[model samples]
Target: MTTLARLDQFARERKRAWAEGTRRAAKIARERLRSACERAGQRLWRTLSRARHERARDLSKRVQHGQRIVKVGREHGMNVAAATVNLTRKAWRRVRGLRRPFVRAGRRVERLGEQYGALREEWAVERDIESLVDGGEPILFGPWTSEVGYEALYWVAFVRWVKMTYRLRTDRLAVMSRGGVSAWYADITPRYLDIFDRVTPEAFAARTAERLVSAGTAKQMDLSAFDAELVESARRELGVERLRVMHPSLMYRLFRQFWLGHRPLGFLQSHTSFARLTMPAREVRIPDLPAEYVAVKFSGAQSLPPTPDHQRMVRRIVGAVAERYPVVLLDTGMAVDEHGDFGIVRTPRIQSVREYLRPSDNLGVQTGVIAGARGFIGTCGSVAWLAPMLGVDTQAVMTDARFLHAHLHAARWVYRTLDAGRFSPLDLGGFARFGLDVAGASELLADRPS
Candidate 1:
């Protein structure tokens, strides 16, 4: 029974107790960790389920909102369509209401036309030289009165010249222009160019007012009424009972289609007719131009201003020509001043005739200036037309082949040669290198009648 044996047994017992405690603690720790992990998993699953439910609810709400919007849009579209249809129906009904009156008016017009058989016969009468001269005072009628200078000079003046060539008395003739005639045209000689500065309706009303006044019904009158009286007085004074009215537009249309479109017909008929017509007497005195200066005209087509490229090419051409002869730039009165739209500054080396010749300058004076030029260069336009008529040796620069063909007579007879053809780009360097043949230009200038 020794104390050491008893102590050994006690130690073994303590070791066993310690081992059991450790085992128990380890088991408890493992159980706690397992429980915590299970709780965490449950919480995660609940959170995930809530999130999924929220997303589903949000998606459903969005889909419902979209459906509601689509329904509203469809309703709105239907309403707009219904409103449009109703409006269209109302307009159609209104139009139908107006159709009867228009039909009646048309019938009345046709009846009136039928009644005026003699007038139709007279209108159908072909204008011969004898008829034009002895028929009576020639009356020129134009739909557009406010024509550009070139149009007035070429078309209007040409028609007037044609009438004059037939020996029509200029003093007795009356020109009826609808809308106000341009000042450039109004300044032309013979004093028979009467511009009906008002519309046809106004003119008719004025004439009625005049008749009423003459019948002693009205004592006082307005300006328009006075104009009518003046017109009537002039007609009586000129001893013109009925004027042989010439429709310039109709003539021009026919000229373009039949006269200009057909090759030899235009040259033989229109051009030859124009040649036979003597130039109208000009009241405006033309200033003397430079003795040997080259005349250059640069302008664009109707309503369109010359492009920068065009101006630059013209400048280059002028410069090259100026090297040989003094260059004079002729303003067509439709010249567009480039307000430095292009970055390059173009200072024309040649002298501008614009300072001398104004927009209001007489067309005769303008023509005279063109005629006096030694060598003429111009764009394919009215000026080019005039050069041929004047027998001036010229070079015409055309942008389009159609335009050149349309004015074949001018292209052939007017210009000595074509400067640039259709589709020729306005390259300054190219033009500078391909300078105008100095000798050819000189020959043209020398050959031109002073």
Candidate 2:
């Protein structure tokens, strides 16, 4: 019997024996941590913002410098993501490999078998152990947590750790065990191995905003908006002619489907302060979403406000861009539900071409779904964030002025407009021009001393 299996059996027997206050003990621990984080965050914020009226440039320069250095390092193959993946994989393998005589629920001792028969067929016992150690065991956290707040914190740390260290996002493994959707194997990266040790709630929030918000003006920008300099910079470096793109869609279905195989633990603890603290952290990653994505007006009796002509206008603009580019996807995720209804139906223009896909199909399968798109277009949604992380040139068009300042980083372009009530199609030529700008900036920056 493997040592781990033996230990697991022992532990399970112990749990069954005590079976009384185990859950209560865990709850108490969670509540304490939540309160601690909240109080700490408030204290930190008061201290950090006490400075004199400093120009935003000071902060931008420092942040941008750090981001750029990280990017450059990745280009040279210094991967924090790979390391994290390896570390977690290693830890997990050990946990899964020890053979043990499992005490069955019916009271008989049976040889505990591999969780996955397929894996057993392919790998010898030792080889399987190696895989687990290298890849770490995925701990599916959903069937929503009993403690939603703590779940949120865990997710925040997990996502940030991966992004910061590996420059890659976590690939969620979905499961269908608990209720509707849940995570099966949520991998932790090295970047986040000791996150709780280094982060307080305030720092976590700041870093989150820094990661999720796009770079530009202090206020949020609409999806169509762009920072001329940022685009020009990317264009100059990558060569304008070579960069191609399609309209942007958030690929909501792809992500939802990816999580389908996972579990969602119900709220595990009850702490209002903890909930409040993690909400902002989650919000930072969510980005300043558009009203249409946020709206869920249905057809016929379910309809409301006619989708504000502006939303349709936005679609038309996206359609125009898609026609000119290799691929264009509209992020209609705000209206998405488990049933696949996105409230607003696609316009004839968008439906006819047949390139539109749910986000899950495009991103999770690990094949050539989005591999070919040269550029990405959208509001500051996950797809936009992900495209740049994957190294695609993206122009995140934000209709809301507030989004421009929202801390979205790594995209090749950013565009916004002042007209809030109206939806104006971002000029395809404008985005093309922006790409040129980005390329140019890249060249200039490249020549500078490292």
Candidate 3:
């Protein structure tokens, strides 16, 4: 255990300790690598299994949808086949001279004629017209054509006649309308016809039948056989001895062809008088509305196509307005197919008016909602035409220029025609004037009539 022997033993011990440390480090590294590989394999398997499950579910849904479609198609085909068989049988009967029974049955099934006769008797008993008239002629005014807006316009001629001639007794006047006029039409007519007593189509038809029976002409009369005959009967029953029966189509033609052109003076005077007489106030309601809300109606009979650009523009306008006031989207639920296309997306500030109001609501309720709104925004449709009549401040975004001047003079409202092809600049000047600012003046422009 001299100095040289001690040094050699210590060096050997140090080298042995280093070799043992290296072996332990290698074992630890191998265990760590094995665990990492196992975890990676588990994650890969899970991802593959999840993807497979989703694919299977999607396939099953597609198969079920296909089956439903096929079933519907089969039912529809069966219905068509049944209809074809019935039609074929009728055609065969007609060819084989065996259609007499069907023809006789059809003749006996004149519900309108029978109903008309019954209605006339009921009216005669209820009204006591013979006593009420007291030798004065009772005048019946209508059998008004169905289009509500034009029906309102047609009344102008009668109003003009009353103003000019002063012969027809307003007190003895009764205005007739066909059944099933919309609540809107019913609500609106009072403004113009409140002066005259009203009669329904049933009563008018009944009266006509009574007259025909009295004249000994009702035996085999079919009122629906000829339009001219119907018109003549209406005139005779209504006691329209000399006054001409004017149809809405005739009025429209006259307005387009003559009244708006060379014969403008009389037309202008009459329409101006009509406007003065017919304007009435409307009140609307919004349930749980915020302090400020803007009502918007975009889809209608003349709605522009819901292209991507149009959708973007709508969103931009709605988004811009929503920042200042809650926006209520008013829709009639007519455009179910275009809902996804025209639906406002990404704006939390807009709500559907349909959520609060139903389609079945009366026209008064509908008009009140539009009239009560702080501001109205819509396309050039019935609602747009109505907004101004209700005295609501309105802004109309129009696609067609033809309607720009059609009823512009009827009421006051801001109208803007947009080019559907391009991204027309958002002009917020109108909204700004109304105290609504979505991106300042860059959002909308207040368009003026030319």
Candidate 4:
């Protein structure tokens, strides 16, 4: 070997050894530093562990009644209310997953199961509806087992989608909705079967009570054996041997996710097709109705709770309207649901259609009155949902918005999308709290053609 070659090989070996030692030294230093940090963290954790236990106990006792708390911003100092403390403790107990990890995992599994079940129900309903439409048999749209608002707003719109999507023959479809509201489905079908014709209003009310008792809800979100019986009865009334059914449950199932906050508003838009409804035909007219009358229907229910204050508000509001235009009170003396008629003694200007209403045609009569109204003022549901479709300006009043927010949000959207009548909200709670003048509030109600 050449001398220079030997020298270069030795130099290369020394450089490689130096680099390997440097790497080893760096790795050992890192490991030692990590170990030291771990020890520090352990010491810190131990010190705070006792502190955390005591601090938690301190916090627990601090929020109790009779324990004066430092007031937060924009407030005066005060002791916590006993009820508030109890509610807080109850709320904390409800979050079991916070303390037990497995509880959270179990809850997640349950929620997943619920979602799967809902999806399965939705798919099953879609399949059933498609099958019924495909059978070439007449589709009986309803023994329509829902509120008037839902019927006018969501249910009818959803049915429009069904007709368009399936290319349903108008001749093969008949609506079995109560209240003589065949006019509401003018474009969908001409065959209108009134439930009142087959059954008396008293019998109808009894049947409705049975349905509600069985379902344990005011809304018909599910179709039960009672519903099947009604469908059968309706078919017999139509004198048809075999008729396919399209129940309100279809619309309820389609919009359940949206109502539950799992889906967006667009989900409803995708499923519903809205078209403005023509007025309930002039043939079913209210007798002796003034040309420029304001239709008013106030019920003591969720929106207008049956409180003395609410009653006064109702009277004052009606009085204010009666001054401007002759008032047509759409009051049904019959007991249907939990809601009751807010009894207003009729005057010459303030007249009720109760005398005009039959148990079966009560809602139909109300709808007709509202359709012919120059303007409508009512609790934030029922006929308020209908008046807009009939192109009358609507002023919907509500005290508690807990139940109304979802419907209001959708109603506002539907009104805008369909280019229907103007909808305005009258905050009755605000009026009660802030001493709003009923006369001033009534002044804001929009004017419509007489």
TM-scores of all predicted structures: 0.44, 0.27, 0.41, 0.73
The local distance difference test score of each candidate is: 0.46, 0.30, 0.45, 0.76
> Clash totals for all models, in order?
0, 110, 12, 0
Candidate 2 per-residue C-alpha lDDT over 280-372 given as tens digits, one digit per residue, 9 for 90 to 100: 112111222221111111121111122344345344444444343322233323222111222334543332112332322222211122223
The C-alpha RMSD in Å for every predicted model, in order, reads: 42.1, 29.1, 39.2, 20.2
Model 1 segments beyond 4 Å from truth? Answer: 1-138, 141-167, 174-244, 259-272, 276-289, 302-305, 332-349, 410-450
TM-score, candidate 4, is 0.73
lDDT of 4 by residue, 87-206 (tens): 566556644423444444456556656766776677677767766887567788887856777888788888889999988878888888777777788888888877777767667667
Clashing pairs in 4: none
The top-ranked prediction according to lDDT is 4
How much is the lDDT of residue 338 in candidate 4? 66
Model 1 clash pairs? none
Please name the candidate that would achieve the greatest TM-score relative to the true structure. Answer: 4
Model 2 spans with C-alpha error above 4 angstroms: 1-138, 143-309, 326-368, 403-406, 409-450
Q: What's model 1's lDDT at 376?
A: 71
Model 4: C-alpha RMSD to truth?
A: 20.2
What TM-score should be assigned to candidate 3?
0.41
Candidate 3, residue 115: CA error in Å?
A: 44
